[model samples]
Target: MATCKSSSRTGLDSWQSRKSLSECLRHSLENKMFTDVTFKVGREQKCVQAHRLIVSIRSGVFEAMFYGPLAEQDEVVIPEVEHDIFEQFLRYLYTDDVTMDGASVMGLLYVSKKYDVKTLEQKCLAYLSSSMTPDNACVILEQAHVFDEQELKEKALSFILENGYGALKSSGVTDLCHECLVKIIQAEELEVDEQAVFEAVVAWSESACRKQNKDVTDENRRQVIGEVIKHVRFPLLDQKYFAKNVVPTNLLTDAEKVKILTHWICPNENVSPFNANKRTGIIRQEKIIIQRLAGLCGFGCSCSSGADHGIMFSVNQNASLQGFQLYGPYDRPTAHYDARAFITDPTTDDVIEGSSVTKSVSVAAGTTTYDVEFPRPLKLSKDKKYNLLVNINGPKSLYGKSDRSTVQDGSFVCSFFNCQKSKHSNKLNRYTDVDEGQIPGLMFLV
Candidate 1:
C-alpha cells in the first residue's frame, strides 16, 4: 500500500550508495535465469533503485533485497549472513512461511537482532525456547535478559524459575533452584534476613503452582506471598519431561523433603558438574528461599501451611537444595553396601566420615552401580559445608549397568560411611572397586 517514509523527504544522504548499489545489482541480475519474477509496482514509477531493490537477492531472499518498502516496519537489512541463512530467507520470501530447526535458527536470531527484524527475532526466540535444555535454557535466559527482548526475556526467566526447592529437594535440583532464586532476588535488589532464615526450607508442591492445577487448588496463600518474593515461573521447557520416566513422581510419598544438593554439583550432558544455579547466584541461601519460595516459609512459621510463601524457613537438620543440575560419570571407588550408595552432599577433598575411608566396588555392566539417590526428605543450609559420603565394602558390592538400575534403600541410610574405631581396638577398613561395565564408584557431597 503506502510507504512509512518517502525516501525523497528523508533527505538524500543515502542517494550515492543507493544509486551505485542498485545499478550494480541490476547489472548482476540481468543474465540470471528467471522466468516470471514480479518486478514493477503499479503506482510507483519504476526507478532504477526500485527495480534493483526488488530484483536483488540477499541471503537467497528477494525480500531481504526489497524489505519494508511498504512501511518502516521492515526496512533494516542484515549483511553478515551464511549461504544457508540466505537460503532460508529466500524460502521465506517465496513461501511467506519458514520452518526453522535448532542449528539453522540460532544464527538467524543474531541476524534478526542485528537487522532489527522484530518478527523474525520473536520467531527465533520461540524456537530457541522450545529446543533448549535446562542448562542451555539458563544460558539463553541470561543472554535474552541482556538483550532486553522483554517478551523473550520473560519467557526465558519463567523457564529458568519453573521449579522450586521443595518439589526438587529430594529430586536432585535443589541446589540449582536455590542458585536461580538467589540471583533473581539480588537482581531485583531485594533484602533478605539471613538469621531469620534456616536450612529446612519447605516450598510448595510443583503441581500446586502449575496453571492446570490453578482451578483445582486454591493458591491464594501462595499468591499473596508471591507478590513479595516473586516466585512465578514458566513451565515451558520444564514440562517436556513431565510425561517421561526421566521425571519420576510418587504421589503417595511426594511430601518428603529432598537430598538434592549433590545434583547441582554433578555433571550434566554437557559434562562437568552442573553449576546452573551458580550461573544465577549462590545456593541454599535465604534470598533463594524468599525469591523461589515467595516467602512462603516466612509468612507465619517454618511449618505453617498456606500462610508462608517461600520465605525464610526455620533452620533444621533437613539440608537439601535443588536446581538445574548435571550428573554424569562417578569416580570408581569401592562399594560398601549391596544396595546403591548415594552421597547427599558433594565436596572435593573432604575426608569421608572424618577418616581416610577407602572403598570401591566392581560393577556389572547393564546390571549394577553404586549410584546415589535420595530415599528421605532433607533440607540444606546456605554456605554450609556438609559431607555426603558413599562407602563401598568390596568388589562386586555396589554397581549399576543400566541407569535404570537405580535402587532406593528405605533405611534412610543409603549412604556408605566409615566409622573408624579407636586405634587400640579397631582397624582401618579399605574397600576395592572392580569394573563390570557399571557406573564407577562415585561419591558426591554438596
Candidate 2:
C-alpha cells in the first residue's frame, strides 16, 4: 500500500501527470500552484539521473532545523500525493531546509525519494537522524534499503544493531525495521552468517542468564523478544484473522499448554546470588485477560468443590503489555490469582463508582472490549492500582464459539475488584448494581 502512490487525506487531488522530474518541478514551482514543497535534482550513474523533492504541510521550519547542512536524511513517499506531502516537497525547494516537523515528514520525503531527489532526501534524513527512534529510524532506514540509500540505511542499522551486538535478536517487525533489516543484510559479504547470528544471540542470552542466575533456553530467547515487544507495542492486532477449523473434542496439547502457561506465568527463579532463588511470578492474586483472544491467554487448573472440575483459561493483551503475564502452572491444581485490574470499589462494600481503577469502564456486561472506554486516555496510573478476580468458568472463545463453531458457551464468570486502599483515591466509589447498564445476577460485593 505504501509503494502505491496515493494521498491519505481524502477530498484532495493528486499532483498527477507522468511528466519528467524537471518538468513537474518547473511547473509546480514557477506558477506556485504547488509551492509548499522543496525540490532536488542531480545526476548519478551517468545514464540514471536523480531528481528529489519534498512536500509537507510543515516545510518552512524544517528547512531551517539543524546546524548548517544536516547530513543524515531519509526519503518519504506519498504517491500521487496531496498536501500532506507538500511540506517535504517544500524542503527540497532548497538545499538546506531544516525547519520542518521531523516526526511527520516521512511520507513526503518518500515521494522525493521516488523521483530520485537527493538533496531534499538528505535534509529529511538529517532531521530523522537528529531525533531518532526505534520506530522512525527503522522506517527511513528501510527507505534507504529500497532505494540503495547507503548512508541513511547505515544510520538506522547502527541503532538497531547497537546495545552490544544485537544482531540475532528480532527487534520490532515494523515497516521501518523490515526495511532496515533488509538493507543492513543486503549483501552476504556485509553480513554475519546465520550461525554467527545464532552464536551472538546465545552469547547475549548467556550473559543475561548469568546476571540473573537462571536457565536460558530457546524459549528464553523467545521470551526476551516478547519483552521487547511489550515496550514497542504493535498497533496491528486488530487485523482480521481467518478462523481455522478445529474438533470440538480437542484439548490443548502439552506444548501448546506450556506455551500458554509460560506466557501467562512468566515463571522465573531469581538466579540473583544475593536473593533467595524464589519463583519470580507466583503471587496469590487473580487477573483478567481482557485483550488477547478476548481472554484466551489465561490458564488455571481447578478441581475444587464437587464432581466435574474445570480448568479456566483466558488471554488478554491490552494495547500496553501491562495486564499480560503468565498464570499458575498446570502441575499446580486449584491456584489462587490476584491480578491488576479495575473493579468494584476496593474500600467500600457499597456501589461501584465512576473513578474505578480499571483502564476501561463500561455500561454493559457482555460488551465487546472495543466498546469499553477508559475514563481518561488509556494510561497506567501508579497512585491507584486495581485487579480482576475471576473464577475459572473455563475454555471459552473471546466472542464465544471455539474454533469448531461460531457460537460459544465457554466464557468466564469473572468479577472486578478494587485494591486501591490509598488516600488520593477517595473520589472512587464502589461499582455496583445501580451503575448504568449493570447486569442483574452479578453482584458487586463490598
Best candidate (score: TM-score): 1
Model 1 residue runs over 4 Å out of place are 1-32, 35-79, 113-119, 163-446
> What would the per-residue lDDT of candidate 2 be over residues 215-242, giving only the tens digit for each residue?
6655554444332222111111111210
Model 2 / residue 233 / CA error / Å: 22
**C-alpha RMSD by candidate, in order:** 22.4, 19.0
lDDT of 1 at 379: 38
lDDT of 1 by residue, 1-446 (tens): 22222224234564334556435333333322122332222233221112223334323244554454543222233345655664454344333456898567766676566545566777888887776543355445555655666776566556544322222232222222333434543342211121111111123233334423453232432342232222221111123432232124332112211212223234232311112223132233321221111111111111111111110112222333321111122333322223222222333433222122233334433333223334222334543343323322333322122222122223111122222222121122232111122223322222
Error of 1 at 218 (Å): 50
User: Which portions of model 2 miss their true places by more than 4 Å?
Assistant: 1-79, 91-99, 114-117, 163-172, 176-446
TM-score of 2: 0.27
Consecutive 10-residue window with the lowest summed lDDT within model 1: 292-301
